[model samples]
Target: MAAPIFSLAFALLLRLTYATAQVDPALISRACEYAKGGPTCVAWLQDNEDDAELSGIDRSDPDSIAFFSLKKIEKEAVTVSEAVSAKLSAGTTEDLSPATQQGLAECKDHYVPAVDLIKEGVDSLAGKAYPDAMKFLRTSTLDLIACQKSLAKLRTDKKDTEADVHATDAINRRDLLASHVALAQSILEFAASGGGAAAASVAAPPS
Candidate 1:
């Protein structure tokens, strides 16, 4: 249970500033492929596979494809976070948004510590002893959502202030870093639950 969280933490630590960072088209397609399963996850995989085929076709510029792919990944993360948080809070679809700041507000106790800790890393979080990190991780989906808004607003602001896309890409880079941190906490919370344990246990040598 704790191992996954720890693993994610380590991954994010290595990622440093690129937490929610967007990947190339090929990576996005690959992630979607892994998510697809039978009726539940598989349908997604097939769709993503199809999407991958069209990846480069949609772009005259390479950055367009990267931006589009990044959007897809961020959107998917938002969708999953919303679904899980809604399940936890018994809320509705109105709760989730990439451009809004609702997810964290609605579920802050459950996710902020993880968010902060991931941002800060394991040596900083201090393991299971730190309940706040767990709470933060639970709400990481929300942070990702808020990050989207920050980046969007920053873009608009940048247009009024300067010529560099630096303000925009810099914001995105920050969000990506936060996303990675949240992902670490999410992986931990998921692994700690009975469901995670069972799943992990199954992939190991028989007792």
Candidate 2:
């Protein structure tokens, strides 16, 4: 009798758990919208990763996966910085084309928060809280992925309306940046989920 009762309770709990679990696949959508399709962060990552794989540029050198990931995050960061610089250079913060303006804003608000989370995750990993660190990186990765998909949509929407080759190049660049950011974000998430280190090896102890 007791065994039957225990089984019933277990089944009931499982049902309740499943009923309350809500996964928001669209969470990234909100993040992407916030950044408005900016791609600076993404493009930087791909270029560097390509260099690493093709030319042996190993700034981070975290085992193959971790090393590649660090290189990628650095790339995204550089791209983000460059985008900010471009915006300043253009002097068109408010006057940007609608798509560009939207992407820039999203990056500052939504995508940036994701970047911050990943940074915290990286820091946490160094402090021995692997689980917590992975959480932050994973969250950031999801949001960045959403940001990428949105930027692609934004590019498709704007490509035809570009005024000339120069204008087209600018739009393409933004899309490229977004793509790279998305890829980097995904890579980070993959690392965090696996419980493997994404950081470079520690220094050797003195004898």
Candidate 3:
């Protein structure tokens, strides 16, 4: 009787192991198709598929994966916006010209809509409101561009200064946010084609 019990436990362990190892390849392929960096996306998904945030999600479903990917990108965009805001605020303390200061102010104003738009877009996508999500995503992209233009208008007067460095940093942050926006747009398109979940079961993947 003990032998039979041990045999049953071993069989259950084997089944559990197989289930844990069964990740769908198509989900990785689909994510690569939509993300900006295909190789990076593929590698990231493979490495982070077992993260806590991805727990309970079916690795075989491409739609679930895409929805989680969009939400992750949304969170990343918010971080980038915060970094850009910090850089802009730091620039205000430097010896910037009056015009440059005003431009920085305008840049801050542009970011006001930029930060929350991605979050709204994510929520809209979760609700299956495709049009609204797309609008918010596109508007967020526009806001990033507008922020860059505001920084461009600022005359640094010389290169390698603190203000110039911070402005450049802001531009880099904008570009990062732009990539997230693009990724979000692609995911939204996929979800619109009946990819998003009817209910929010899947959460974000790894960083």
Candidate 4:
């Protein structure tokens, strides 16, 4: 009887483990293939597998993966926006030029709106309003690009090392967000087309 109880306990543990296991590699590959930057999408998903909100999701479903990606993007946008705001608030003490200060303020302006758009996009995604979600996401991307370009212009005109550093960082982060936006768009497109095995099969394998 004790042996049977032990076996049952082990079986339950195995079941729990399986329930919480990472998404299947094949599934991740298949879903990521839809993104413009497949490898980046894969890396993001892999790195965020343990995210509190993502961990509870059914990662096997392409739609769920897309939703998770959108939420992640929203979170990133919010974080970047807050960082910019913090920088602006603390800039009073920094030896920043007036032009640099204005540029950073503009970046904050762009980022604040971008965060709002991303949040709206996430909400639309949750509601299965794919078109609205994509529209909002695309607009958010534009805002991020504008912020990046603002920094670039400042860096170019001022030739300030600090501005250059900020521009470089913004470029890298914007590019990552763009990739995630593309990923979410592709998955949303698949879902809009009646996502299933059939819709998934239409995508060509990643090179």
The clash count of every prediction, one per candidate, is: 22, 14, 0, 0
User: In lDDT terms, which candidate is top?
Assistant: 4
* Model 3: residue 147 alpha-carbon error in angstroms: 1.0
**By TM-score: ranked, best first:** 4, 3, 2, 1
lDDT of 1 at 47: 36
Rank order (by lDDT, best first): 4, 3, 2, 1
Task: Give candidate 1 misplaced runs (Cα > 4 Å).
Answer: 1-131, 140-144, 155-163, 190-196, 199-207
Off by over 4 Å in 3: 1-25, 34-37, 40-60, 154-161, 195-207
lDDT of 2 by residue, 150-199 (tens): 34433322333322332344345545554544544444443343422333
TM-scores, one per candidate: 0.30, 0.40, 0.64, 0.71
Query: What is the C-alpha RMSD, rounded to one decimal, of candidate 2?
Result: 18.9
Global lDDT of each model?
0.36, 0.43, 0.60, 0.64
Candidate with the larger TM-score of 2 and 4: 4
Better of 2 and 3 by lDDT: 3
lDDT of 3 at 189: 63
Task: List residue ranges in candidate 2 displaced over 4 A.
Answer: 1-68, 71-75, 84-96, 153-207
Cα lDDT for residue 106, model 1? Answer: 37
State the displacement of the C-alpha of residue 200, model 4, in Å, after optimal TM-score superposition: 11
